[model samples]
Target: MSTKKVSIGAKPTNKPATPTADAWVENRTAADAHETMKRLTIDVPESLHRAIKSQCAMRGTKIADEVRELLLQKYGNH
Candidate 1:
């Protein structure tokens, strides 16, 4: 006798896929009212990096968003 395999889990939906950067920027505007976005890179200690990632995950946040908020608070013009 032959048996068919069945999948158990939520089925995929027909919703459109959003690009990572686009989704991240959605409902968020540039601080300067400009249409350009720039990438910033910095090096951090491995332990610090892991800690930030873990905390962000637990808080349901993104590292980039958190960093941006910090930078804006420090240097952005009110």
Candidate 2:
């Protein structure tokens, strides 16, 4: 049997350092400047939701993004 000592409070050496607070805030500000976003919710059947999720995954897209594009296509001018 082999035993290794570990420190509970020690940070992992292999991981990259996290972004500074200033950098994160700057990035978030830049993103928010492009658009103000709102949330929409609708009830969906379980099977329909699963199918949509599967299709989005296969197409390398997020379900929300796909829904946004669809909405834009249908009613963007109005």
Candidate 3:
């Protein structure tokens, strides 16, 4: 399986302005507004739950992140 490279806590760079900076800010704000998180609860079999817990423990990630990644991969980003 391929792994994604993520910068867990990278700082944003302070760079010189470009002509499209205003548009970039507007678009990013709009995207952020629409991307708010919501809570979800689901019931799964005990074995499946154990597997999820095991995978998360091995990878040093939470079950929620793993579930979200799997869902986003199986279904198109909505």
Candidate 4:
């Protein structure tokens, strides 16, 4: 297979990397609201908490989102 090499100075396509403000506003619906929000407090070792926080920062997301994603993957969003 042949590979195409891009020039170092080439500009990227005209596309937004992430969702735009308009898209975010339009895509958010009533179902997205935290209607059944509940507090989940747990005690963990300081090292574990620090690791979780560091991973969350690296992924540019909140601990809550990371935990929710894990829960969704394990238990599903039923």
Candidate 5:
């Protein structure tokens, strides 16, 4: 599938531009997730659920890693 920006009504943009001299990006560490992990709720067929679990075990990682990889791939962060 292809994606293009589309505006149904009036489109909006920033009216003011700031000086680029002060622009900077910050570095951050990954979250501490071993002791406390994130949870998700999704519906899937029984066979698909078993397949996903088996894949995770075969890859020697948790379901969460598979989920994170998937979400990052979709959302442009990894």
Candidate 6:
């Protein structure tokens, strides 16, 4: 067998180092909506934080749902 020293710049690239935006997310249909959930984040002052937690427990639901309901009530158009 013969030995060969390949050139340093001879390597080939078939793709980009970073993917396009479309590659990051895929299109979804209504069928997928039932299987997926979204998350949101918010910051509250320490004084009223416990009250929010208690309200969530009273509603027998997650803190996220409680917050969403409150915002919808306050800003219905949005």
Best by TM-score: 2
Q: What tens-digit string does per-residue lDDT give for candidate 4 at 8-47?
A: 8768797768988866755664357555555567899999
TM-score (C-alpha) between model 1 and the true structure: 0.54
Candidate 3 positional error at 67, Å: 0.5
Candidate 1 residue lDDT tens string, 1-78: 999999899998999886787567554567766655566889999999999999999999999888988998999945
Model 2, 48-77: lDDT tens digits are 999999999999999988887899899993
TM-score of each: 0.54, 0.55, 0.52, 0.53, 0.48, 0.40
> For this target, which candidate reaches the highest lDDT against the unseen true structure?
1
Any idea what lDDT model 1 has? 0.83
* lDDT-sorted candidate list, best first: 1, 4, 2, 3, 5, 6
TM-score of 3: 0.52
lDDT of each: 0.83, 0.79, 0.78, 0.80, 0.70, 0.66
The reply for model 3, stretches above 4 Å from the true place, is 1-34
Each candidate's clash count: 0, 0, 0, 0, 0, 0
Which residue runs does candidate 2 get wrong by more than 4 Å? 1-33
Give, for candidate 3, the lowest lDDT window spanning 10 residues: 25-34
Lowest lDDT 10-residue stretch of candidate 6: 28-37
- lDDT (tens digit, per residue) of candidate 6 on 23-78: 54443323425543344567888768888788778878887666767877998933
Superposed Cα deviation of residue 71, candidate 1 (Å): 0.5
In model 5, what lDDT does residue 53 have? 95
Candidate 2, clashing residue pairs?
A: none
Give the per-residue Cα lDDT of candidate 1 at 8.
Answer: 97
